[model samples]
Target: MKHGLLWIARALGLFALCSWLTRRELRILCYHGIWDGPGHYGNYLFMSPGKFRSRLAFLQDWGARVLPLPVALERLAQGRLPARAVVITIDDGWASTVAHMVPALEQAGFPATLYVTSYYAHNQRPVLNVALAYALSRWAAGERDSTLLPLPGLGQLNCPAGDAIALHRATDQVIEHASTLADDDARQAFLCSVISATGLAQDPVWGGPAFRLASRDQLREASAKGIDLQLHTHRHRTTCNGTSCLAQELADNRSWLTGVGEGPFEHFCYPSGQYQASDWEVLRRQGIESATTTEIGLCRRGENPYALPRILDGESLSELELEAELSGFLTMLRRISRR
Candidate 1:
């Protein structure tokens, strides 16, 4: 039904009309990693390099004026935004992104901001949460044995191999426990245990460097190559934990990021799109010029700078869906439905 509607909207020129109407609004595109793993694994967190290249082609063909994030935000405030202005943002600073996405962006001569969550980057490890999710999803059907993987304090991770909710609960428990481990080495050992238990230590997503964050040197190289490195918090968390947690995350994130590049590192993206009313003053006090969320829609003047929206361009989104989104037809439909 939705696909049919989109086709009809295109046929009726609604896409064109919506694009023209929202041409002045700022469209921030959010992306994550580029998947270089063997075979096709459909994950929202990663996409193939070819897909990313095609996305850049789409932006160019659609006549989008890609601007540096900071410049775009400044222009947005001054109402000097060009028609179909777009800001391309990448989250997490994945190794694949630096190896694949950054090169693609540079080849296209487009400016992009990378929101780097410092912990994994500095620690040089696969993100624990992601590793757990992958491990749980791939644990064999009959291998529901809790004793397969054991942690010192977190006991057994007994979970239904097929029940997603149960698996999520188990993952969370282990994650919380992993956080309490002594050090990065301990955490790495824990992850190794998980990989071994799932018998997936040989998988590229688990064993290879693909799932890791870009190292400090690689990030520096990307920065040198013109990718704007920005803050995404030290641990990929937000103010929901409290004002102090948010403050520490920012400070640590800033400390690591500043060591990588030059000055003016001010933009932020909420870790996991979590934010609240009380967050505005905290962010303002911390020198944050703008903060983006995972919220969907075009950003316009007068909207809160601390909670700007973005279009999450990911593996699941098709080209037609991307067109509908960029043209503002999807945003219009969303707004009408909300009313």
Candidate 2:
């Protein structure tokens, strides 16, 4: 109750301040996945669709002028924006995003920029980590015998063969290696074999569209519905490979986008929000107009286009929390209180 009251007070204070002079900073909101139900199976990267809808409604009801990201950036570049300007961006391609978010967005009449990981969209396979997560969820670590695989730093990691502590460590160890596989096919095959050999029942949802990437049909439909498809690179990691690899990854992402008849990609988002300062040059060279990072702050003019920041909202955030979030008052109080 104290926290709730504090947030409400913060909201009131900001509204009073804004009555005299409005804050013109443009806010970029980032979301990842949207699911109708709770986040499950180590999949906490989702926001409840109902909450997402409510947040949009609140923004619209409060009269925030939501804009497409590219348009918002263009307007901001020109030295102005609508009052309380905001751009909605969802990162990484998830089928639930198309399934649940599209309807919510249409209801709110808001436009969003979706940064899709091209490799997943092109392959239509469950993300290797997500698959690993699902498998790990139901694992009875002592249930079965599978030949142990060499796990790099860990040596001979076993599945359905370790204790509770061992299984936890093994999950991390496996995902790390999966992320390094050269090709998606090899990674998928490796995961499939591991899951099967471990006697783990692959969740039914995994094979269904729920855990897979959005289909080409879905991407085209989202485009028709006013979503901007942007670059998130082919493998979702850029700097891990060299600078040239970064360019090639983006090239692959665009090629996939073009093949689906869905885009003229202009914007980018760093995968896992990981990037180095030097990466800005590579992105600019690729003709990306702007790139957003996981950094948190309102964007302003003269800010580096290649290193823009965003406001993150998720299933756990409530309307009141967002009220305090957008106001900037809550953060201020927290910083002061901390000091």
lDDT of each: 0.85, 0.75
Q: List where candidate 1 sits over 4 angstroms from the true fold.
A: 40-42, 140-162, 239-243
Q: What residue runs in model 2 are displaced by over 4 Å at the alpha carbon?
A: 1-5, 15-22, 36-44, 137-168, 179-183, 193-202, 241-244, 259-262, 330-339
TM-score, candidate 2, is: 0.82
How would you encode candidate 2's per-residue C-alpha lDDT over 20-106 as one tens digit per residue? Answer: 233566789888886543244322377776777788889987678899888898888888777678889988878888888877898
TM-score of each prediction: 0.92, 0.82
Lowest-scoring 10 consecutive residues by lDDT in candidate 1? 140-149
lDDT of 2 at 334: 53
Which residue pairs does candidate 1 place in steric collision?
A: none
lDDT of 2 at 137: 50
**TM-score of candidate 1 versus the correct structure, residues matched by position:** 0.92
